[model samples]
Target: MTAHLPASGTPGADLGAAVRALPKVLLHDHLDGGLRPATVVDLAAQTGHVLPTTDPEALGRWFVESAASGSLERYLETFAHTVGVLQTADALRRVAREAVLDLAADGVVHAEERYAPEQHQRGGLSLQEVVDAVRGGLDEGMAQARSAGDDIRVTQVLCAMRQGDRADEVAALALANRDAGVVAFDLAGPEEGFPPSRHASAFRTLRDASFPVTVHAGEAAGLASIGDAVHRAGALRLGHGVRIADDVHVGPGGEVRLGRLAHWVRDRRLALEVCPSSNVQTGAARSVAEHPVTMLLRLGFEVTVSTDNRLQSGTSPSRELELLVREAGWTHDDLVAVTVAAARHAFLQEDERRALVDRIVRPAVSPGTARPGRHRA
Candidate 1:
């Protein structure tokens, strides 16, 4: 994380210093979203699952190239290879354990990794068994990080596919594991025809239980879907809430106008989990430079950057921040504000969240400290 001080008056120059060292808080990440290509190939071979390619590097490139089809549906086909290999308890545990270590290595202080338990049950394991396997893996990963003196905390977010009718069951699964490291609930999967309102019963149950929820909205769908997630599903945060920009307009002479939906999102301060590369791959946006994340940040919306799927999109949180700095001209203050906003809005206990802000974010931004540099293991 070598900090490169930007020349005077350069766009994003200040951000290079701040974003590099900032103790990031990640609220939206998928467990199956990130996988080492070699691990995938090995796990596939171990599980006897046939793969499109046996070579690790070729298989990795295949994922990135195949995902360039410019549609979320097409991008998701690459997951068959990953999910196919992650069926057994041992496989699930290894994946989960490695996921935590990877995030820690990437400098994530706290992360919430979501996955659908229902999807991993094809190997004759019950939903509880699946959760236990993942949890055990996470626990082992945490122990390893602690041994290495890396301060990283991880929580699980149980996702129920909006296209399925098992939302209530998934909600119950989350609640069942609430004290066992599960922090929240989510609804993921194709968002076009599957409006979040379809899962109202499950949302109602979670709300009644006083649990936090985030919905994958405004990505494949539009503002109406985001509206349903917040109004009907009670989402505390939004996953890839990029399309909310559809409601924002910029006029001549730098004047900006916000439609009803955009204004509400800004005013409510709901965290928007913006993933730049993933958005481009899914055709949600034209390119990283054209991403609305900058607009939303300038408009005072709570925006937290993320890598929706590292393997598929070929990105990391640091890389995402760097791309925004290079393309969008974000500064150190902007970077600090966004990272702090993510930490502030993380779905963790109040005291734990505060401790992270004070111990990590504050020091990383202090003027006398060394400039942000790459993580050297």
Candidate 2:
């Protein structure tokens, strides 16, 4: 390992410019949750929809303020305006393009934007149509980023809404387009009553076919939900699996004990998609200072930071990293470690992962630092 950061080091000294320039890989972003506020206004107007605020700044503020309500239900309600405006195929494409551009601007070299194709059918678009439109827009944005000398690649992770019954269909769609741009499958939505086990058939189908799968659990739900995501669904990554912190026991003398489930998670080397700001907005953490990501990292969990819902959380990958630096006092090595781990677990092919590490991640970390190795029980 490289030298430990000095206690008096100014971790966030050059956050805005220096940290923003580092390469990143994002695995938990939502397509609809990352729209530009101005684009949302334009799309709503084009679709004859009513918005809480027409001004871009106010609209953005509304989304952030509403999701900060601390109730999972209320936090999710902020997506209504975004999803409503994205009913049209063109609107979906535009948002997809903007997401790519925004991530590239924040130095994301690789990302998998996940969304439910089922939600965009209100305007008569087939599920496949929404998928294609989004893919096309991402391709356009990637080309533009390349033209601007930004080393970036964006892929799709098709998500099946947990509250619905279309998981199998979405899985099939992901398989059909896997060779093109669809890289993975995920189950995303309210995770309390509707567990990943509810979509066992879909997960079974994907598992038998050896498809990459992730599930949103342990965010709005508890450890059982995360267990179902891992055992029943065969998920390789746990989306917002921060609730595993609940299973940890701390002694007065600074000793830590992990429960069986938490031990299994760590021993298996499963990736935990942790989103700090989004976690706070949804009441997972009272504030960034109390976030469990630092603890999980210290405990040797395969923890990777992300901006789950940039719009609703009023954040970006750069902002998320900066927050950890300023609030949690993360060192440069800490930031580099998180970014490298995310790239390692990305849904890309082995060759792609290698190239990403070489071209984007390695330069961000200093020489002689220990790299994350793939280890499992």
- Which candidate's TM-score is highest? 2
TM-score of each: 0.93, 0.94
In model 2, what are the clashing residue pairs, if there are any? none
lDDT of 2 at 72: 84
lDDT (Cα, tens digit) per residue for candidate 2, span 123-167: 999988999999999999999877776767899999999899999
What is the alpha-carbon lDDT for the whole of candidate 2? 0.87
Per-model tally of clashing residue pairs = 6, 0
TM-score of 1: 0.93
RMSD of 1: 2.7
- Which lDDT tens digits does candidate 1 get at residues 47-165? 88888898989988889889878999999888898888888899889988998888776667788888999999889989999999999999899889877766778889999998899
Candidate 1 off by > 4 Å: 5-20, 366-377
User: In model 2, how large is the Cα lDDT of residue 358?
Assistant: 83
